[model samples]
Target chain A: MAKVKHHNIPLDQIIKPENIVFKRTKLFTDNVLSYCPGCGHGVAHRLILEVLEEMGIADKTIGIAPVGCSVLAYEFMDIDMQEAAHGRAPALATGIKRTNPDKFVFAYQGDGDLAAIGTAETIHTANRGENITVIFINNGIYGMTGGQMAPTTIYGMKTSTTPYGRDPKQMGHPLKITEIVAQLPGTCYVTRQAVHTPALVRKAKKAIRKAFEYQKQNKGLSFVEIVSNCNSGWKMTPVQAVKWLEENMLPYYPLGDLKDIGLD
Target chain B: MIVGAIVVDTERCKGCELCTQACPFGIISMSEDVNSKGYHYAYLADPYACTGCENCALVCPDTVITVYRMKVEEPSKAKN
Candidate 1:
């Protein structure tokens, strides 16, 4: 049904300049996001950029884009961004951070790019404690590749590669990559979060801001894993997929801090 | 008096409805008509009910919604 015109009052008259509470930040370009409708990637991207903008480091920050759905993240993020080969964002971020020590360097990668193809690079970056941030978006499957099973895909989840569902005996157990990195001494802060709701989104932003703050202090590696939803890949509507994630994904990949060395 | 309002960029919205669900006051709802992109956009169904909590803007994946809060004015002493 068509929305009724508001009380015959002009919008400008109703919404004044001083009454503005929130507006889009300039840190993001005008380009529309390429993510699917209701995809968590958009929220994750916004949170990261918002954190950078709030910290006043948008001009001095460099983002490394992975080879997955967000490979073109550089286009949307109005900051210096470099495209890395498949699963090589962490490695690229390490080189960038080491040379430009003053810049805030971060690698944005998906579960397939981080936990699968680039496992070695991901591990070593955290092991060496590279003074950088890693933003991992785990949607459980390879979203850009037609919904194939990913290393982080939970058990019994159906994917294009596993039509009958993921069999742990044949596919091996789902990888807890965030937990794996938290065990390493090099990681200064590591947390898992989501953005399905407002409260969760706020907490996720806090974690991201903390990650950047740690980066400013020259703290070791900081990793933030965001468990997200892939509606198109999972063959569900946006709403259904999010509900499924809450019911199925959260239990296997619980959200919380795994490691925090604290800011000195 | 109304304390809050929101502006939705109709063309940019994907009609995901997350904002509708996220609005604690249930003021936002999907439009019957579609935008230029053929997607139904969200609008404030009950504008006066908005509390400026920003919950809808925070959950909107497209980032098309902007929230505004009104400033409460004190009574003028000159009137006395």
Candidate 2:
């Protein structure tokens, strides 16, 4: 049988109240995602907004966008947002959460911003157990400023800066910042997840929601490390990148909950 | 069984094909035609097979796909 063509049909004529199953959340501005096609950042951004909308705290939430690929997150997220300097999102979130204890606070950061330049701020913030949530995107490279080796770039992984692949002898080892924070007494929840597949997307959303719920209960700092793909930075197509992430990235940065309240 | 349909925002689609990969029924495929962005967007190749599970919209980075599902009414249950 021949397939029906839908490009000629108007969207309104296709969508109706009785059959509508899913619609884009209103928390996201209509600004088309700026990230490269197939990049994980956009999905991560949607998951965060969906959580905010589900929790009924979109108006009461304040997001701190880090100086990385998501620097313009303030423009995309409909809720109130603040842009933080390179690696300073944690520090800013710390201050904001302290001042506005009643509001839900979160910092969205990339690996470079959280593991490289923001190491000091990140550690101290988690150590202090600031009543906030940190959504960390670990794509293992500096995507916005062009592909470069990041602290979380797995050993032997190739980035533009590490063309021949990362060398621990010259570059140093990959940093497990999420695990480091989980050991801190201040942090109440810490987990690692991905959004490349349908099952993982659902799990990632649940992790995001759980992190926010922890913040609402004032349970110290909740950290969610989303091990994601950077298709453009890695010089691979979106589909290829997702496959590479599963084959190469997953073994090193395995997914699952690292720490949770009463879960050890 | 429930029948599903989807509205793809051709202008917004990046042709990533994640939706095609996510469709459990293998009903979605890249279109032969290109949108304004010069990319071959995803389209419902076998719309009748769609179950409206929403996996396509869930993984779409651009948030361009809106899904719909319809439960066909049964004549036997119409009396009730």
Best by lDDT: 1
Judged by DockQ cut-offs, is candidate 2 incorrect, acceptable, medium or high? acceptable
If scored against the real structure, what TM-score would every candidate get? 0.94, 0.93
For residue A67, what is the lDDT in candidate 1? Answer: 93
* Error at A63, model 1, angstroms: 0.4
lDDT of 1 by residue, A1-264 (tens): 222322323356658777788888788899999998899999999999999988999999999999989999999999999999999999999899999998999999999999999999999999999999999999999999899999999999999999999999999999999999999988999999999999999999999999999999998999999999999999998888889999999999999999998898
True contacts kept of each: 0.56, 0.58
The C-alpha RMSD in Å for every predicted model, in order, reads 3.5, 3.7
Predict model 1's lDDT versus the native.
0.90
In the range A1-264, model 2's lDDT, one tens digit per residue, is 223322222334446876787888999998988899998988999999999999999999999999989999988899999999999998999888889899999999999999999999999999999999999999999999999999999989999899999999999999999999999999999999999988999999999999999998888999999999999999999999999999988899999999999422
lDDT of residue B64 for candidate 2: 90
Local lDDT at A102 for model 2: 96
TM-score of chain A of each: 0.95, 0.93
Among the numbered candidates, top TM-score falls to 1
Recovered native contacts, candidate 2? 0.58
Clashing pairs in 1: A1-B32
